[model samples]
Target: MKFLFLICAAQGRPTATPVDNGTVVGTLGPVDDDVEVWVKEYDEGSAEDSGRRLAGDRLTGHTETVRVRGGEVLVTDGPFLESKEYIAGFDLIEAPSLDVAREIASKHPMAHYTGIEIRPLPE
Candidate 1:
């Protein structure tokens, strides 16, 4: 099975290593180095990298909406939805089972600091 890892954080760019919150913190996972290793492991045999960062770094706190209604097109400038979190990027991987996939996701460096949502492809 193949899964998509949606990396999320409560603040800015997906690349930022989050600061420790005031709450008690536990052991931290390896950061940038592990990310480099993870990327190399996934990209070694592929034609292109298995993952890529998103453009949330350029959000500028504004968004544009597009829609077609009543046979006409409409455009608006504003946030479509309210969200305290943003998807920083995605990683696509193949695993034998959901458990294996979850394990892979948990290894992502940001998984310790942020959230990773695992989703299987329907098709």
Candidate 2:
């Protein structure tokens, strides 16, 4: 089975202080062979700046959102939701079962200060 671990943190909270990579890496046990991890830095400045960064260009901040209602298109800016949390990164992992996936997620270094959501992928 495969699962995705969504790493999240509070919206306004600055990124956690850096920890020794070796210390973080040591927690995975043998499951390291079955997982691929990606880390993302928290977005700073304006939303337009984030959009520009996402586009690999130089600009201000703002993320565009488009919606269709009554055959009319609506465009908006900023995040998709107004919440206290944002996703910081993710891990895609293969495990023998959900139990194994949960165990793997619980061992992630970020699990100590951030939220980790484990979700199964469909076949």
Query: What is residue 99's positional error in candidate 1, in angstroms?
Result: 0.7
- For model 1, residues 1-123, the per-residue Cα lDDT tens digits are 667777665554334443533222122334546666766665553333333322112124555778999989999986554786766567777666677777767766667667788888664
Residue pair clashes in candidate 2: 46-61, 47-61, 47-62, 48-60, 48-61, 48-62, 49-60, 49-61
Cα lDDT, all candidates: 0.59, 0.50
lDDT of 2: 0.50
Q: Residue by residue across 36-118, what tens digits does model 2's lDDT show?
A: 23122211212321210121111233567899999999998776767776565565666667876666556555575566788
Off by over 4 Å in 1: 12-30, 45-65, 76-79
Give each prediction's root-mean-square deviation over alpha carbons.
7.3, 13.1
| Candidate topping lDDT | 1
